[model samples]
Target: VYKGLDIVTAKVTKEEQAQAVHHMIDINDPLKEYTVVDFRNKALSIMDSMIKSKKTPIIVGGTNYYIESLIWQTLVDNPKRAGGDDEDSGLDESLIKVRRIDGSSNEELHKKLMQVDPDMALRVHPNNRRKVIRSLEIFEQHGVTHSEILRQQRLAAGCSLGGPLRYDNSIIFWLTCEKEVLDKRIDARVDSMMDKGLVQELLDFHELYNKDRLKKNEEADYTKGIFQSIGFKEFHNYLILSKEERDDEKGEKLLQQSIEELKRATRKYARRQHKWVRNRLVRRADRQVPPLYSLDSTDVGQWESEVYGKAVDIVSAYLDGRAPSQPALNSVITDTRIADNSTETSQYCEVCQRIFIGAQWNEHLQGAKHMKAVRRRRRQEEANEYREAVEIEGKDERAASVEAEA
Candidate 1:
């Protein structure tokens, strides 16, 4: 969401953007952090204006959290008014500051969250510093735990954690691709970016913004703005090289390594996007979701007929209040073993030294790594027990020998 990071982001060129209007493109300063909440608010305002003009505002993006904020009543605007109790219902004049606590590590922030809202802490991993901090901010700003706010919302709406849908007349279209095809497409895209002077773009950006910070021995903050973009951090080593060094053989190898890393990261990110669609939109049995139509985009050759054509027909049918010929995709069957209240809470495995949230715990228990850890621990315990037994036997014999000698 910043200027000058266009190549890595694969931002549409001015020519491409001119073909159609786009919102929220390069609207924020690169130095400043632009959050999901910020995106949601601005996008919502644009959507409202479009609705007034009788325009169908089609929300298109890969960022699920930002899309979730727009679709569901997830964010707690004001806790006082949210619960509708006799408690302070007045607007909080103070801003809801969702930032890290100064001088506190991620674990420390998570501990503070555990103290205030154990339920939320259970849901969020400590390593996810941003989310842990956000949960803490909720409690600090509203004088109510983040979990409590979600509970109140659930009670009020008689629905799931994020409450009901913001718009009743809404539909979701999930465009899916085959895994092998997607991997190839991602690699090709990365190659295209490199051909489009991605290295030079990073070099210019680093020279402009990051050179001074590096010279001062300050760590690169990848948590903010355009720095968080996949290509930037992946190319850090190559970007830091001097012009003469960058021309050397070692620098060429490093540059290739960076490109490979970028490709891998992009592929990994694509997998996460697919997982989000499956977990959040498709198989979430606990919450009410809009009808989702899956469009197979695996074969780019048939994009018009399989994807675009199907999407247009589905949208038209929905707008006309008629059922489309193509039926909505069914939710994937949830695992009965993991589909329990217990799974909603966090489960920590001492053997693995890892915390698993919700269904993750069940999955982890069944995983090879966890089982291996358990077996290793069991063997260690057995060895210790056998050693203790031998020592006891030796001690008894020594005592009897001493008695005889006396």
Candidate 2:
């Protein structure tokens, strides 16, 4: 929305495009569902072409998971595509009647997954139905449990989890900023987006894509596509307000509220990015994981010394085939990895809608809440079966009476 001023803009100036090539930017319509799987496939294709041409592909973005999937083979396919792309995970795309956990309650879905793959169910949170369903779908399509597949991948990678690295020679640079400075920048950025007509941009997007869905009171899923951007859902209520209401004091209050909410969401998303870098990127059970050099951007005044100059020296050394030196000021996280013993078979409690790992599963099974939920589920099953039986009996009686009359 901020045009050239924005960091993730695809509309690069003619001069910049002349200097360097860019890939995987503005490749999809905002309304359509462009999943991460799609993104990884497309990006890999671009990276391969660039590599074949002897060009170094510089992947720049804040989407840590996307970058992770690109650098590491995290996006594993089902058995059919074990050594292939996920374009054909052996799933039928034509079937509309495919059983999905999307509309089902968390408890019901968890129970279903438990019936098929109890161990997998334990690892997945009940609230995260999308992951649960995807795991179940993989099991159904490939006839192998998701956990088993992950176990195989981990064994191959020499780690407790995660797959092999796509590019071993890759060096990653992580830009770090102090929490106070970062938060303030994010707040200021949100305000700048507002000045750049963020609200109007959201309104335009909603009208173009979401109007039909909203008119029918259908679910506006912010989980998929470009609508997952920070500002879209934050201004949902403000967008839905009528013209009359929007012109009043209530609209002004809601707009201010939405601006604050957008700032808060941006901050939370920034924290999540940092967490992914720390936990997934840096901390790995396998020592072969890629080394990430940290670059401190806490002080903008020292950008030339801390960020740009240091980056230049590291890249130059890397190109010269010398071991890249770590910056003294811009330090790496040296916290040793702690072993998690929870990998032992986990169980899901239907009552608490929670998964208990290791010994906790046994304790949870004997808990009062779980026992009560079990009893309730049994009662519900019995009632449903009885109702079905009654309907069958009524049909039989009607058939007998018709036969007698004939």
Candidate 3:
């Protein structure tokens, strides 16, 4: 499970291949969908085979989601099946046909989810259209919010929120470095990628898949497939530039911008990877997830002692059924538990046009927007009551003024 782009596995030397058998590396066509579930199933099969053959299997990768799917049951298997639609298994009608959330703007999708599952909406980044859409789909398909379903799943599994760990005995190693050092390393990696002809690779990829799709007036979504790779989209505009444009001043500026964009994206991705490891995997206190050993990679001078040496020792101790001296990092725990998922009792605010769930409802009550709306409505009610009183009592100017003042 080398969780990386094809370019990464392509760079592997012949000697490396001879050293050990590798699985799930460069196995999927770049144009096709190799989903996390597919990877998890295949990786599990490979691991099982390796175990039976008495060979140790090592799964390495930066794609935390794929690793997460492998280590924990985080995905919803099938909403239809869970909702008792087993009878429609003939032509794959079991799949819920909720309108593609991508059809709407990302903001719209996020806002919609906020209405149904505000807590989930808050947890999921607004820019993450995929997660937002999935949450919305769960709500639309099952008549239950995503948070409610997650709560049910957590309760069933006896885990807080990340779901139950598939392997409680598994040991995870997190290689960490200082932010500035990591950023510089990421910039260097981007430069290396460019030196390796990332531009040419993107051009070839675009010609094969994106060009034809665009010519036929089809969508070339960069959010899916290998296009989601950082370099691919960062260089999208540069790749589209004509050869004539490449020799011009504007082209040079665009090229520089794209290079900087690539570096920034790489650094951002590194931060996201660390955040996932710290927040999702390490913070869960409900059940035994996995023992994560943090290796400080800040100083490359200590690589042998800090990373490789520590990893070898930790693995050896685990194999020997002894506790390793390597201690786990302090838990970076946050409130992952869904405090409330009572969608049935949820109130829909007309002003905000948002659904308020338990604690969120209370918070909404105190929110500035809600308070302002309340004041506005109260003023309107007061005006209406005064008008009614004036009409019924036939009050003169003095009485009306007194009532209004009061």
TM-score of 2: 0.76
Using lDDT as the yardstick, the better of models 2 and 3 is: 2
Candidate whose TM-score is highest: 1
TM-score of each model, paired residue for residue: 0.84, 0.76, 0.70
CA lDDT of every candidate = 0.79, 0.72, 0.71
Candidate 3 lDDT for residue 72: 79
Worst 10 residues of 1 by lDDT: 82-91
Candidate 1: the clashing residue pairs are none
Question: Per lDDT, what order, best first?
Answer: 1, 2, 3
| Model 2 stretches with alpha carbons more than 4 Å out | 1-19, 78-101, 212-218, 327-333, 340-406
**Residue-level lDDT tens digits of model 1 in 45-81:** 8889989999888888767887888998888764443
Quote the lDDT for 286 in model 3.
58
- The number of clashing residue pairs in each candidate reads 0, 0, 0
Q: Mark the regions of model 1 whose C-alpha exceeds 4 Å error after superposition.
A: 78-100, 211-219, 240-250, 330-343, 386-406
- TM for candidate 3 is 0.70
Estimate, for each residue in 1-406, the C-alpha lDDT of model 2 and write its tens digit. Answer: 1222233232455687678777655556565455566677777888898999999999888577778788887665544433334333344542112244467787787788888888888777776766777777777776777788888877777766467888988878889999999999999877777776677767776676667677778687766556566776788889989878878999999999998998898899899898767666576556356667789999999999998998889899988988667643223557776354327655656667776766568887888888988899999999999999999999999999999999
Candidate number that wins on lDDT, 1 or 3: 1
